[model samples]
Structure formats: structure tokens, C-alpha cells
Target: MGTVNTVYWIFTIGLAILLLTAIIVLLFLWKNQGQLREENRKLRMSYDEIEKKYTGVHAEQLRYKLNPHLFRNALNAIQSHAYQSYYALDKLSGVLDYILYDTDGRLVTVKEEIEFARNFIEINRLKTSPLFDIRIKNKINEADPRCHQAVIAPLSFINPIENAFKHADLQSDNAFISVSFSFENDSWFVLQVANKTNDLPPSLNTRGGLGNDIYLDRLSSVYGVEGYSCKESINNGIFITELRIKIS
Candidate 1:
């Protein structure tokens, strides 16, 4: 009986030591797990910051890519009509200011962007006349404070309109370019541009839609691929492009 008691005490002490060892191991694992979670959180935050910066950098690059195309057109119009009206130079200044200062890859107000498009239209009109079939419809309340606060990617609305002009069958009587801007809702801004396709020389016709590709890339970066909506179609000799963005 004495030997048995001694053996039982030894077994109990061994079990107690084993339990203590297991508890210590569990505590160590818990501490390391918490530290790992913290490290992972920090790494995720750093990755997001890097991604945002990369987006901004590439967005800026895309915006500037077409600045030269706009500049070339505006300067040509200003030079072609500089002798006829002093207004050409004034319009040129506005275009220059907008292109130089406002194209910083930041979100701009709806009013500012539409106004820039209007200014661009007027500048380009120096090349055409009242008889030209260029139609513009605007249905947004610019005075609303929300329109000012609601923002979208800069230079986002111009590509389709510019393409309409560039590819339009201007010499034909049936050629018409129509552009519209309106708010489908308080937070949704939409731009639609349609034009009759023109038959140009192979040189110009071969490179169609290159500008719009850049536009798409910029918007994809700004709003994500699925965040915004775009629809393009061609029917009965008319090419229509519509884009809708949810402003924040």
C-alpha cells in the first residue's frame, strides 16, 4: 500500500507538469497569433497606400496623353480664325488654362467640367458655322450646391464629344453630331454623344478610338471596372456612346 501511494503521487505530479506545459504552449501561440494579425493589418494598409499612389500616377499619365491632341485642335482653330475675331484668343486662353491647370487627375465639379466642354465646343465652332449640325443639350441644374460638391474624374466627358467631331461626316447634309449632359439622379451624371460616321482617308480611319481607350483606362482606375457604366453602339450609320458615372 505504501509503494502504491508513492506511485500514485508520482503519477499526479507528472500529469500536473504536463498540463502546465500545455498551458504555456497555448499562451505562447496566442501571443504570436495576435502579433501576426497586427503585422498583417499593417502590411495591408501599406499595400493600399501604394495601390492608391500607383493609380494616381497612371491616371495622371492617361489624362496628359491626349492633352496634345486637344492643344493641336484648339491652336489650329485659334490660328485659322485669329484674324477674324479677338474672341478666338480669349477662348484659347480658357482652353489653355483648363488644360494646364485643371488636368491634374483630380475629381472636378460637374459645372466646371461641362463649362470646359462648352468652351471647347465654342472654340471648335470657329471652324464651322451656324449651319453645322452640332447639337448640344444640357439638362442639369448647375446652381444646385450638390452639383458643385459632386465630383467626377477630370476630362472624363470630353473624349466622346471630341471623337464625334473627329469622325463626323461633316461634309454630308445628313451628318449630325449630338451631345447631351444631364443628371439621371442626384448622384448620377450622364454624357451622351452621337454622330454620323464619316469616310476619311485610310490614315485617319485606321487610328479611330485610340483616345477613348485612354479615357476608359482612366475611368477604370478612378471608379473601378464595375463602378461606372458605358454603352457603345452603332446603328443605321450612327455611332452612339453613352457614359454614366455615380459622383461622390
Candidate 2:
């Protein structure tokens, strides 16, 4: 063959080989891309299913956490006293009146909860006559009454507050009580009450009156898993107690 024709033939063969290689590479890439797209679709579906399951689980947890007795007591009290207004006794009765009567939902505001706690604390300090310093710092949320609002359990703190006073020592200066409330995240509402007890009285320590048992039972009934819990610690001749829960 002539030299020019031989070179042309070689060059043409090389070009054909290169074109074949490029076509093979393109085909392999297309197949791999299709598989990757399928995998991505499966992953997205799996993620969506997991998200839905988690939502259902969370909603179920909320349902279980919501105690029925808390609102039930408040509603029953109001229903029982629907015929009368006890405002007339406001002056004659002390904190006990608020504790017992206010359960009817007349003063069902958050402020009333603080007022009730204050009265209970005062009566307790008087009853125990704590020689040690007894202090109460209350921060109440004064909500607008014109707006419709939900209800909180009646006498929510009455038993627990009284229990603290009944069982806590009167001689220790660590007898401090504080109550505070705040709104959070535009959804979560919280109320916290804390107190230092003097010491557990014999009655409380021994469970003689079933006072502690009843107290815990009522808390369980009202708060379920969420209601009336205390974190108690002792330090330097002082005892501290804290209680926290979501109100709304």
C-alpha cells in the first residue's frame, strides 16, 4: 500500500477504537445513574415513613401524659356549686376558703393559683409556726379574663404545699418556699413551686396518716406522670424541694 494510504488507514482505525470506548463509557454511566436514582427514591420513601411513625408515637405519648383527673376535679367542683356564688365569704374566710371554695372555677385564672398557694403557705407557716425563716416569693401571670381560657386542676398545690408544711421541720432556717410561672415557646406553659422542709416529721416519716401515700396518689391521679414531683436535696443543714410541671 502507498505510505499515505497506510497512515490514513491506521488513523481511521484509531478513531473507530476511540469512538467505541467513549460509547461504552457513556452506557456504563447511564446505567449507574439509573441505579443511583432508584436508591435515592427508596431512601426518600423510607425517610417519610419513619417521620410519620415518629409523629404518631409522639402524639400517643402526649395523649398518655394528659391526666384526666386534673381537669375532672375542676369541672366537678364548678358543676356542684353552679347554683351559688361564694364571693360573700371572701372576707370571713382565710386561705382555707380559697383552697376549698375556689375549686369551683370562679377565680380560675393563673393568678388565682398563685393566690391559693400564697394563702396555703401563710396558713402553713402559722400552723407550723416555723421558728426558722419561712419565705414565699410568688410570680403570677395575670391573664386577661375576657379571653376564653382552659382550666387547671383545682387546689392543685393545696395538698402538696400542706404536706410540705406538715412534714417539714420548723426549726431549720432552710424552710423556704417559692412559686413561679412563665410562658415558653408560645406553646409550653410552666409552673414551679419549691420549698425547703425543716425535716420529715415522725408522722410523715412513718406514713402513719397515709398522708404521704395519699399525697402521692393524688399527684399521680392529677398529674399522672407529669404531676407534682419534688427534687429534694440536703445541704449544710438546709433541705430544698422543687416541683415543676407544664400548665398549658
TM-score for each candidate, following the candidate numbering = 0.68, 0.45
Residue-wise C-alpha lDDT for candidate 2, range 110-132, written one tens digit per residue: 56666666654543443343255
Worst 10 residues of 1 by lDDT: 200-209
Candidate 2 TM-score, true structure as reference = 0.45
The list of candidate 2 runs beyond 4 A from truth reads 1-92, 104-107, 128-132, 143-150, 172-209, 226-230
Clashes of 2: 2
- State the local distance difference test value for candidate 1: 0.74
What is candidate 2's CA lDDT for residue 215?
Answer: 50
Candidate 1 lDDT over 129-219, as tens digits, reads 5588888898877787657766666777777777777777777888888889998767678899888876533232233456666677777
Per-candidate local distance difference test:
0.74, 0.49
Q: Clashes in each model (backbone N, CA, C under 3 Å)?
A: 0, 2
- Candidate that would win on TM-score: 1
